[model samples]
Target: MTDSSSSPITVRYTCPHCDAVHSIDRAPDLADRSVTKHSQPGWEYATPDDDLEVRETADGIAFICGEDGPVTDLEGKQIEGCGRPFYLNFVRFEQGVELDPNPATYGGPRFDFNG
Candidate 1:
């Protein structure tokens, strides 16, 4: 069964040659857009010659190099310059709550005058 409590909020890039994996965390809703922009010039410096393949499943997305054999990211495409097939996988989720900071005393309970 899938974990409905939370959704994947990160993308992991794994290099086939070097076996190195890089993880990028983002808001769950923004993951798709973030992955798509990686191929853009200003976003990741990927050249038109660089073959980029993207696959999306119900859970997440994957980006792989279409070229045969090993590939290198010497241009710093947000990944290490590893000579191998580059794979980007997004499948892990983090569950948590974001709360605003309180300015009350450190050891005291919060109080509301309106209450």
Candidate 2:
């Protein structure tokens, strides 16, 4: 049942038993999405299970959500799911809004990749 036929689509859920991984493409709405807590800070983590979701499902691999954009209250925590710490460059946006995963600029993003 899992193959190219199910490519580009896979069910996703955290194991209720032990936070294990769970995936299935054709579930009967039992695992339907409800608002889930953003799990990261600042994003207001959609606590009740309502909202749109974009996800990927595979074995042993858990979700690492950007949660609308980035996690807040970093207080030194790795920016949730990306293993990145907060940088001061992004202090302007309304906290959790993004056109893309990373920061964007009118012309292009400025990165310190050269060094």
Candidate 3:
């Protein structure tokens, strides 16, 4: 897994009440379109705006505090992948990209790739 912190479009969310920022990472809303890349079929997606409901920041973006972390929804934030009452994440990994998992219990090689 490669460190995505410096990814092209890295996102983060913050809590307005307690000022506690919970990185929200959820899937996108694409019901009518099928994202296929090199035979890698992407999943469908939807956003919170569809339902006219705003989540936390309403920034319309999703982000994970780190790898292996629970997904969160920025609510009102405008994130790339999110929907009505979202709690997941959606992202497109371009070709030649690398992923570096965080240093947690699941330890092994510093990085990995499906192919």
Candidate 4:
């Protein structure tokens, strides 16, 4: 079998406001570990943490952009992007990987409602 950890999964995201493109390489093993953290007790119902840049959701991973941008290149230059945060939804089967359809908005204003 091949080592999935050694292979870096490339995830490319396009800015919604601008046409600038951004790409990131994520380790499968690390991504899995981050996603697994979402399952901890009270994690789902917890409030959003502003300090977190990257967070895992029930469906996939979210890339929270800062005031500067999302990621930088090998030369330490920030990639050209609109700086708008986005998400990549994972379409998984059993234990293997599949396709990521498109990037979605990362976050927005939250409101509490009582029924």
Candidate 5:
């Protein structure tokens, strides 16, 4: 049996604007830093006027816009509203089993782990 604890963990980040997803393999030491970075305002290049809300989900974590909401596009620098919320989903792969290429399809970042 393989020790799941030491297995590589994949973190998927979904964009609220275009439903575009970005996935990154989590390094044990840098996990907290990655989470903190995503939990900050304008992390997605959103306007500074907007507030960010962090919530703990079964899977990993979620970052959503507060009252002001998503008021700008980071890449385009436009004032378009992306009302959708972003999610950070975590998944573990068993030994020899291939990891899913698209973690976004795992259904909105709901994981069984508390942290």
Candidate 6:
């Protein structure tokens, strides 16, 4: 990933099916949250608005095509891209390592519910 302590970190990849170039800008601090305490190198979440759910790891990142349907530009015009799920593998040492789907879970909740 590009280094920048304050600026947004941009991740770029090519679509597998359509070969379209895509870029995602993430907060610089996102790198810090990418890894779990258990050392599992990744993070997964759905956007609060329920669009663009993605899973990212040291090995790679996977994105659901168009979130729900065709992706749109800031003006709401549809941008051309294959509406299919795709994975981008981060090649390391000439190989791509896959992460375990289930990593060690963090110990339950921080506060007691009965309070």
Q: How many residue pairs clash in each candidate?
A: 1, 8, 42, 0, 1, 0
Over 1-115, each residue of candidate 6 has an lDDT whose tens digit, in order, gives 4443456556544455555455665444343212222222354343213322232224445555455334544444557666665654332332455333333333543543685
For each of the candidates, the C-alpha root-mean-square deviation to the true structure, in angstroms, is: 15.8, 14.9, 15.9, 10.6, 13.0, 13.8
Clashing pairs in 4: none
Off by over 4 Å in 2: 1-8, 13-17, 23-38, 47-115
Candidate 4, 1-115: lDDT as tens digits: 2243475565555434443445555445433322221223322221123222233223444544433245554454666554455444443333576432222112533555899
Residue 40 lDDT (model 3): 20
C-alpha lDDT of residue 82 in model 2: 35
Question: Which residue pairs clash in candidate 6?
Answer: none
What lDDT does the true structure give each of the candidates?
Answer: 0.36, 0.28, 0.29, 0.40, 0.38, 0.43
> Estimated TM-score per prediction?
0.23, 0.19, 0.18, 0.35, 0.27, 0.36
In angstroms, the error of model 1 at 56 is 4.0
Ranked candidates, highest lDDT first: 6, 4, 5, 1, 3, 2
The prediction achieving the highest TM-score against the true structure is 6
What is the Cα-based lDDT of residue 107 in candidate 1? 46
Q: By TM-score, rank the candidates, best first.
A: 6, 4, 5, 1, 2, 3
Query: For model 5, what is the C-alpha lDDT against the true structure?
Result: 0.38
Q: Is candidate 3 or candidate 5 better by lDDT?
A: 5
What would the per-residue lDDT of candidate 5 be over residues 36-97, giving only the tens digit for each residue?
Answer: 22333322232222222111112344545332333334443435345455544334244966
Which 10 consecutive residues of model 6 have the lowest summed lDDT? 31-40
Q: Residue 43: error of model 3 in Å? A: 22
**lDDT score, candidate 2, position 71:** 37
Model 4 vs. true fold: TM: 0.35
Clashing pairs for model 1 are 71-84
Residue range 1-115, candidate 3, lDDT tens digits: 2233432232344332222234433223311111111112232333433322232223222222223233344444332332112222223333855322122112333554678
CA error at residue 72 for candidate 2, angstroms: 32
